[model samples]
Target chain A: GQQVMQIPQYQHVQEGEDFTTYCNSSTTLSNIQWYKQRPGGHPVFLIQLVKSGEVKKQKRLTFQFGEAKKNSSLHITATQTTDVGTYFCAGFDAGNNRKLIWGLGTSLAVNP
Target chain B: SQTIHQWPATLVQPVGSPLSLECTVEGTSNPNLYWYRQAAGRGLQLLFYSVGIGQISSEVPQNLSASRPQDRQFILSSKKLLLSDSGFYLCAWSTESYNEQFFGPGTRLTVL
Candidate 1:
């Protein structure tokens, strides 16, 4: 099984501030996907990065994949109260190909 | 449009009781299904996944097991629930190509 480590288990920022979380894997990844789970809600897919050094943006959210495909990051600009939740990054291990290696996640709290 | 469903939005069970959680995806065929658990203040953990009917894969060894009786149905079961089993359980489905996964509303289980 592959392991993905996430940094800064939790963060708290004022509304309109910025937040970022990083996901790192020890091995190369076939693809990486990001998800967000609101308080007391299910997780929703945010984005997926397949190509190395790929960068994608959705509204105020930005996703980046490392050049080596073993790391990824999600950056939220001008966060809002709606952004308060847990953000998780899951990686598909090139070795296993079937199982997704999940990061511990970074829980964000936005204060107005 | 596709949707994923999970029943009993929340559950409270005594330790040692049997447990069964159902997950279903609509409007898709031959989808890849997955089961994940998120504990308090922790990240998402992959539990099981299925690629097709009657094909299931367990990512971790625990008191829980999973089954895919139909192409779009995935179920998680346990002979006896443990206190540690309490958490948020999520079911997700992705296309056969293994891209982003859409998650269900989730079920919060509390074992005492």
Candidate 2:
């Protein structure tokens, strides 16, 4: 069974601070995706990285896939009150079913 | 524009009770559908996925079953609910050859 692991299970920061969360997998992945879930809200697709060593940005958020496609990271610049939520990374093993394995989300709390 | 819709934003049931949840996608044809469950303060877990009508693959062997009767309609059912079934259920869809998925608002199920 393939599993995705995320670090810093929880994080709290001031509204103007920056935050970063790491995601790693037990096996190689075909691609990786990032999602954000606000409190009491469903997961929202943020971005997807398919190429090794790829990086993407959405306004204040940046996502990167490792050169080996076995790890990833999400960094938020200048977090705001609205950025308070959980961030998740999902990926699929190369030889397994297409069902995505999700990482335990990093819960982000921003203090104004 | 494709949109995913899930019914009954919240539900509460007792153990051994039957349960059904519906998810339908509009503006997309023959999309891949997925069912996911997320426990409070945890990550999402893959439960089932359907690539087409009457075609389903279960990721987790549990008390739940999924069916896709139409191209855009997916249903999750359980003959006997358990307390552990309490969680936030989500439905997502993606187009062929593309991995980015769009998620619905999700259903909050509480099995007492």
Best by TM-score: 2
Give the C-alpha miss distance for residue A25 in model 1, angstroms: 1.0
What's the lDDT for all of these models?
Answer: 0.90, 0.92
DockQ of each: 0.70, 0.65
**Candidate 2 chain B worst ten-residue window by lDDT:** B94-103
Error of 2 at A73 (Å): 0.8
C-alpha lDDT of candidate 1 relative to the true structure: 0.90
Error of 2 at A29 (Å): 1.5
Listed in order, each prediction's TM-score against the native is 0.94, 0.96
Winner by lDDT = 2
True contacts kept of each: 0.70, 0.67
lDDT, candidate 2, B1-112, per-residue tens: 8889999999999999999999999998999999999999988888999898999999878999999999999999999999999999999999953488889999999999
Candidate 1 regions off by >4 Å? none
Model 1 lDDT per residue over B1-112, tens place: 9989998799999999999999998998899999989887777888998888898888788999999988889999999999999999989998853588888998999999
Model 2 DockQ (Cα-based):
0.65
CAPRI rating of model 2? medium
Scanning candidate 1 chain B in windows of ten residues, the lowest lDDT window is B94-103
